[model samples]
Target: KLVVAVQGTRKQHVDTVGPKVDRQKKSPVCSYNEWDPLDEVIVGRPDNACVPSLTPEVKAISSPQQWEFFRKFGGQFFPQEHLKKAVSQIEEMCNVLRHEGVTVRRPDIVDWSKAYETPDFKSKGMYAAMPRDILIVIGEEIIEAPMAWRSRFFEYRAYRSLMKEYFQAGAKWTTAPKPLMSDELYDQNYPVESVEHRYKLSSEGRYVTTEFEPCFDAADFMRCGKDIFAQQSQVTNLFGIEWMARHLGPDYKIHLLQFKDPNAMHIDGTFNVVGPGLVIVNPARPCLQSEMFKKAGWKLVEAPKPMVPDDHPLWMTSKWLSMNVLMLDEQRVMVCKHETPTIKMFESLGIKAIPVDIRFANSIGGGFHCWTTDVRRRGVLESYF
Candidate 1:
C-alpha cells in the first residue's frame, strides 16, 4: 500500500497509483504557430494603462508629429475618457471571441501608474494592454519575453497568475533572461529629426538599440510551425534573435527578415503570417525577402492603405495597425470595424472578417493581434516553409 501525507496530517494508504498519463493530452497550452484552429487565448487589459516616459528607445520608434503627446502625457494615465471607451471596446471584443467558440482569459488589472527602480534604471509602468508584446506561446511552453523597454520590465507581473495556473496544469512556462535595461542598452544620440536620415540608417542595418545585452519584444517574432521569422528592429536586436534561435534548438528554424521601414519595431504590423503559406505584407514597408516567400509558393498579399483619419491621435504607432489583424483560425480573422479596405481584402482571400471597433485601444499602441496572445490552438507541428 502507498501512503501520502495530507496537509501535514495523518496519511492514508491506498492501492498503487497509476503511471502518469501523456502530458501533451493534459496540457492546457499547445500552440505551435499562428492560424491554427482556435482553442484558448489571453486578452490584455487597459484599466490603468500609463504612458511611458519619452526615453531614447521610445523616441526611435515614434514619429516626430506624435512627440508632443508623449511629452505632455508621459508618466500619466492615458486620457480617462478615451480609456473608458477603450475598455468598453475591448470588453466587446472579448464577448465576440467567446461567442466564436473560443475560450478567452484575461490578465490581472494593476495600477500601471506605480513607479519602481532597479540598480540599472528607474521608471514607471506601462499598461498590460498588449499581451503579444510580452507573452508568446510556442508548442507546450509559454515564454515571457525579456522586454526591451524600461517601462515594460515589470509587465510580466500582470500575467503571473495565469502563468502559474497554466504551469500547475502541466504546461511549461519559461521566462527568458531579464535584461538590465541600463543606459548602455540604448543609443542615446540616435538621430530622429530627419525621416530620410533615419531611413538611410535603417537600410544600413543600424537601429537605436545597441548590443550591450540581448533585448527583444515578443511581438518582433512571428511563428510559423517549424519555421519562425524574426526581424532586427528598434526594440529587437540581432543578439536577441540569436538567443531565440539557439533556445528553440534543432527542431525549428529561424529566419532573419528585413524591411524598408525606417522605424521598425514589431513585425506583425509589417509582415503578418496569416496561414500555412499566406502572408500579409505591408504596402508601405515592403519586405526585402519577398522573392524567398514567392519561390516557396507562398502567396504574398499587400495590404491596402489604412483609412484612419489624420486628425485621430495615433501617438505611438503608425496607421498600419489596420494590417495588424488577429487570426482566430485560418478561416476567420478579427479586424477593425472601421477599416473597410482591410475587411474587403480578407473577403477577397476567402477569409471571414469578424469586425470589432477598438479605435481607442489602437490609440494606446496595438491592434487586435497585439492585444491578445493565443494560449492553446488545435494543431500539430509541421513544416510550413
Candidate 2:
C-alpha cells in the first residue's frame, strides 16, 4: 500500500519518500522588471532557423523593399553564410554573459525546416533564436506566450526542457491559451502595399490579427514591476492585451500604449523601459502617450539615429533595434558594438555599455533585449508609475 499524506479538506499530497520540503522556498524564476540585477537568463539559439512564409501577418510588419527577400527565401533557412556569422556572434554574447558572472542557459537546437499542419493552417517553423518573444517572467511565474505568427505556433517545444527544470525548482509556470491560426484569425485583405495606409489602419486599431482569439507575441509587452506596458501591433491584438490584463488580475496594471509606427510589431525597439523611471524612446516611431510618462515623472529620452548601413539586410525589423538593449542591472547595458551613438547615449546616462557585435544576428529580427529572457533577477515587486 502506498502511503500518502493529505492536508485538511483540500487533499494535498505530501511526499513520504522524499526529504522534508520547505514550503517557503523562493521560486527560481523572479524577475519583476528589466533593469534588476541579473542572475540567470535563457539565451536563444540560431541553429536551423527558418524564414517564415510571406503571409498577411508578415506582410503587415515588413517594409515594401524586403518583400522580395521573403518571397524568395520564405520556408527556407536564412542565407547559410549569414547564419554562420550570427551563430558565432551569439556564442560570443554568451561568453560575455558568463564573464559577467551571470548563468546562461540555451534552448535545444531543433530543425526548424520541418513542416507541420494543424486543423486551421499549415506552415514550417521559425527560429528558437528569440526567447524574449515567447517567454515572459513576471515575479515568481513564467508565462509562455501564444505567439501570433503561424511559423511560431510550435516554438514553445524548444523551451519545454527549461520550463520543466524551472517548475521542478519551485516556479509557477503558465501557458496562455493558444490561438488557432485559422483564416478567421487574420485579416485576409490587410493593406500591405502602402506604408501610409498601414499607418492609418494601425492608428485606428485595425491590425492584421483579428479578435477571433487572443493572440500576442511576448515582445509586444514591456514589464515594469507592478505595471506592464503593452501595444496593439500587427502581431498583438487588443483582445490579447485584455486577456493578459484579466489573467494577471488586479495586482498588475497593464497600460496600452500607441505609437506612430507604420509597421509596429514589437515595443522593445520603440519604447524600451530600461530602468524604473528611464525609457529609451525611438525618434522615428514616437509614442502617442508620451505625456503620461512625463506626468509620472519618467524621463523619455529620444534615441539617436541608428547607424546600420542602408545596404544591410534587416529582413524582419528596422534600424531602431539600436535602442533594444538589455539591462544587466541599472548601471550596465548590453548594446550593439557597431552602434556608436547608442553606446554614447548609455554612457551619458551613467550606464556602462558592454558592446557585442551582433550585426548579423540583428538581421534575424532582434537585439540584446530580444535574444534573451532574464529568468532570475534580484528584485521585488514595486510600483514605478
The residue-by-residue lDDT of candidate 2 on 238-328, one tens digit each, is: 8889999999999999999999988888899999999999999998988999999999999999999999999988889999899999999
Q: Rate the local accuracy (lDDT) of all candidates.
A: 0.92, 0.92
Error of 2 at 195 (Å): 0.5
Best by TM-score: 2
Q: Each model's TM-score? A: 0.94, 0.95
lDDT of 2 at 213: 95
Model 1 residue 135 lDDT? 90
lDDT for position 256 in model 1 = 91
Clashing pairs in 2: none
List runs of model 1 lying over 4 Å from the truth.
Answer: 1-24
lDDT of 2 at 360: 95
Error of 1 at 71 (Å): 1.5
Residue pair clashes in candidate 1: none
